[model samples]
Target: MARMKKNFITSLFDTKGKSQDTEEGLTKIISDFFSSIFSSSNPSELDILKASKGIKSRMTGIMSEALGSQYSAEEVKDAIFGLSPTKAPGPDGFHAIFFQKAWG
Candidate 1:
């Protein structure tokens, strides 16, 4: 089956309310609009460190757990085979049936 052609909008209004015809002008307008909405000023260093201090530090534990855990091929095979066969193929055009058969 042939896919339908997608039409792109060519013009945009800049921050100065001026019409922009070129792609670069549109991109600049979008960038300037977003930058204006989401100002660059962020939380200070002390505030960041203060927030992180209360959160659980799991990296060290997770790394150790991962190193200690044993990998099982059966678990991977089970997971692949458990996928829904009725579901459509993903963007790569590969369906779960492919993995299901490959796993077996």
Candidate 2:
């Protein structure tokens, strides 16, 4: 029989019987929650690329904050271009430039 693994959050709140540290439990709980949300609905390549552009912009800001310098426009462009796309978005609520252009 294969043993079932409890989700990170489940384990964290499982006060029923367990000895987990506060930080470890909380970190897993937080990570699991965000991972679940991000993984919930996979978007398309273009949609993901558009979203990644936003994320890369934020990352550049964080990098600039830590390094005390803003990224050059070219650097930002390169960073955004470096990001790869996710799988095709499913039928419902799926939107992509390629799909629209191709179908239209």
Candidate 3:
């Protein structure tokens, strides 16, 4: 039996108090809003760069601990085989099950 699809609230407001209902209009409004925010000049580069060192060092420490561990071939095989064959592929269009089959 097929399940009935629920309607979503796609209505959005534009910058000049304008209401958007069409898919294209909603997409354009979102693109314009995010583009404007991203295109704005950043004056806090120095502050952001200084903040990176602390987080970078902490992340590197965590990665080092994991990277230092040795994994058996059976462990790698088990991990890949655990994924369901019917699961959808990621954006790269390569399904994870492909790797599992390739291991044979």
lDDT (tens digit, per residue) of candidate 1 on 2-61: 233345657898767889989899889888889878774775888779988999966797
TM-score for each model: 0.53, 0.24, 0.44
Model 3 over residues 1-104: C-alpha lDDT tens digits?
A: 13333456468999989899999999999899899987746657887788776773446766888888898899888877887876998678878878877886
Q: In candidate 2, what are the lDDT values of residues 1-104, reduced to their tens digit?
A: 23444433333553344545588776776687688877847557887677767553445667668788666867755554444434455475454433444442
Looking at model 1, which ten-residue stretch has the lowest summed lDDT? 1-10
Those runs of model 1 whose alpha carbons end farther than 4 Å from true positions after fitting are: 1-12, 35-39, 42-44, 51-70
Model 2: lDDT equals 0.57
Model 2, runs deviating above 4 Å:
1-21, 46-104
- Score each candidate by Cα lDDT: 0.80, 0.57, 0.80
Q: State, as a TM-score between 0 and 1, how close model 1 is to the true structure.
A: 0.53
Q: Name every residue pair that clashes in candidate 3.
A: none
By TM-score, highest first, what's the ranking? 1, 3, 2
In terms of TM-score, how similar is model 3 to the real structure?
0.44
